[model samples]
Target chain A: MSFHEKSNLAVLALLTLVFGVYFLWLMPQMAVADPLPPPAAVAGVLIPFVLCLVVLIGVVHLVFKLRDLKEKGEADERDRLIETRAEARAGFMLALGVFGALTLLLAGAAPFWIANALLGALVLAELVKGVLRAIAYRRS
Target chain B: MGKGKTRIANSIREQRFHAGEMTQQQLADAVGVTRQTVIAMEQGRYSPSLEVAFRVARVFGKPLEEVFSYEDEA
Candidate 1:
């Protein structure tokens, strides 16, 4: 695999693992709550989660760069095209997710639920983008 | 009209063979693309842009028409 493909795979794996654990922990609390958990409680979890994710992703990319020093170059035309197409599709996914979150808000859902819904939408959109890019790279 | 049904066909592989058995990576470097892009083009799974087409033709010292041909699948 090219360095880009390998890097993409690594990032995708990290996103899945990190967010998967986060949602698994948060979902149970959400279900048991009347409307939503306290914002402070959610923020407490989120701050650390974001910090850890950034650090982990940074380390992963550093390792990839170190391993593939020769493969490093600016993205060429094909790479740009693949990324553009993937982001376009992911944009649609984000739009759909935002619409759903807005509907929840209209129904008088808690701020916590809306916030999480938006966050979930963003994460899912990113996942979709990553998967599509991977497929494009494979087929290319 | 469908995926993988591109009307454009290329003689990149044959040209590469004539050009001293040029490796895909070498051609890609000459044309400023990734080796995977070169592979995709050779396999007819991808169609490059016009600029890239010209670049590839130039790399092999051939006209664009000699390198790439269009098939009217009407």
Candidate 2:
């Protein structure tokens, strides 16, 4: 796998874990009836997010370890071709998310709500495609 | 662009191999592609441009039809 694909995979994993924690633990515990838990940043969430970020950065370096400060020939023709195609697909995902959000805004949704919705959708699509690309590259 | 059973001409590569082996990377270098690209072509993961295809034949001092062939698949 190329560095581009590896970075995408790490980001996808991080997004899923963080969002899953939000839905399963933080939001549910806050919405519980008995005792409204004080909002606290879970060490669990923070740790994994930070760790994933650090590891992603590390992997990016590892992927480009050779070459130079001016890294040429880090990727061959096939890598470049695959990357271009993947980016085009990811861009379509972003565009679709933005279009849906704009439709909501036109229907009189709160501007902030629309913005948040758009951001969430974009992140989800980005994560999913990153994962799919990783799979596609392997299968290819 | 299309994926199907295609016949590949392996003879030019065979002719280039005086020692019975020619590294894919060496041909890729002469054809201005990466070794990964060569692997893709060999594995049918990608198809090269017409110019690159011709260059690949030239690298082995063979004609294009001798380097690649066409086949119909069901």
Q: Superposing all C-alpha atoms, what RMSD in Å does each candidate have to the true structure?
A: 2.0, 5.8
Superposed Cα RMSD, model 1: 2.0
The DockQ-based CAPRI class assigned to model 1 is medium
User: Which parts of model 1 are misplaced by more than 4 Å?
Assistant: A30-35
Per-residue lDDT tens digits for candidate 1, residues B1-74, read 12564778999999999999999999999998888888888988788999999999999999999999998778
What's each prediction's TM-score? 0.92, 0.63
lDDT per residue as tens, model 1, A1-140: 76677777887888888889889876666658876678788888888888888999889888877877777556878788888898999999999999999999999988888888898999999999999989988766
Model 2, B1-74: lDDT tens digits are 22442355344446447525778767766788766557667766566677878988888777888877775564
Model 2 lDDT at residue A106: 88
Each candidate's clash count = 0, 0
Model 2 error, position B8 (Å): 5.9
Clash count for candidate 2 is 0
Fnat by candidate, in order? 0.48, 0.22
Worst 10 residues of 1 chain B by lDDT: B1-10
